[model samples]
Target: MAYQIFFREYFQTPPLTRAYTTACFLTSLAVHLDILSPYRLYFHPTLIMENLQLWRLITPFFYFGDFSLNYLFSMLFTYRCCRMLEEESFRGRPADFLYLIILGCVIALFFAWFLLLPFLGQSLTTMFVYIWARRNPYVQMGFFGLFVFRAPYLPWVMVALSVLFDGDLETELIGILIGHAYFYFEDVFPYVPGGWRLLATPRIFKLLFDGELENSDYHPPAEERPAGFNLGAQEEQANQQQRNEEN
Candidate 1:
């Protein structure tokens, strides 16, 4: 029962969120079990171009380095941010959320290929974080109960922390840039007097994912007319009797 409650509360989420988190954990488990080498997962242009190893495009987004405390924390953070974005900002709009994921990954791939960067897992995680932060700008957040600040600064803080620990800002920066560009186009730009929506979710996607019933008057048929009920016949007989009395 406890395990059932845990699964219902934590594991159950919208379709995209569930798929993403499951993929990340499954890939991480494969890495931990030594089924695949981490070296093969990182983004490498030569492998992709000459060998047509296109799986590298997506594999990089699943690996979060060797199993450790950092890996666990990264997974949790990714799950949390993804859940918030999917359930809150993109609520009832799974297609739009999926579109954001595709867009972010495409932009990250472009940068990773050209700049010779390797892994993009952290970058994609940061992109989700950046989007959530922007959507909830007024909400207060803290880093491991240490420093507290508004939501908008969360992505920058993560980048600074990454620089402090790993001395590499490439991934985080790319993620932030991509996230900001998306947020600007989707949220900020359309609100401008002369500006129109720049990122329209495809109609096919809306039909596929957002097909909630819109008919307010719709209702289920009455339960099987209670075993041969004949109210219609009785009403017709009464009408005929009233007509005969009037004549």
Candidate 2:
């Protein structure tokens, strides 16, 4: 019972966020256990093309290099932002959230394959963070309680911090651009003249993830009435009095 409560409280992440974080942690564990090699997971066109190792396309977004302070920070940030976006913005819309992830992955893979970039996990994380930050632009956030800023600047701050850590700016920049493009089309451009939703999640996907097309009719279950209330008896007495008056 305690374990169930604990899980319901702390580990009750949205489905997509939970799955993504679990994949990252499992991949990291495999690497730490020497069961998997990071070299085999990185995105390399030559290896993928000639060797036909297509898994490279997906694996690169699971491993965040060897375990270290940077890796831990990246993982935590990814999990937090992804959870926030899924729960707050994409509430009760798992298919829409999944579509966003698919879009981001496709864009990241494009850069990795064409530009010969090796890894993209951080970039994908940044993309999620950027979108979430943009959606909540007026919200104030702080970095380890050191520097406070509005939500929209959070992604740029991460880029600057990445440079400080000697990380590649290209990956982060790609993520930011892709995130901005998605935000513009999905949230902004739809209001423009002759513009329509370009990132619609298919009806099939909606059915699969969300179970039904309409959620506006949702209602909370009523609480059980306390024992010995006897409202039925009171109603019966009132009805009897009304009949007597009518007679």
Top candidate, metric TM-score: 2
Off by over 4 Å in 1: 212-247
State the lDDT at 108 in candidate 2: 91
Clashing pairs in 2: none
Q: Write the per-residue lDDT of candidate 2 for residues 48-129, one digit (tens) a residue.
A: 8899999998998999877887788789879999999898777888888888898899999998777888989898889988
Structure candidate 1, residue pairs in collision:
none
Native-to-model Cα distance after best TM-score fit, residue 215 in candidate 2, in Å: 8.1
CA deviation > 4 Å runs, candidate 2: 1-10, 214-247
lDDT tens digits by residue: candidate 1, 72-98: 767886888999989877776787788
Candidate 1 local Cα displacement, residue 45, angstroms: 1.9
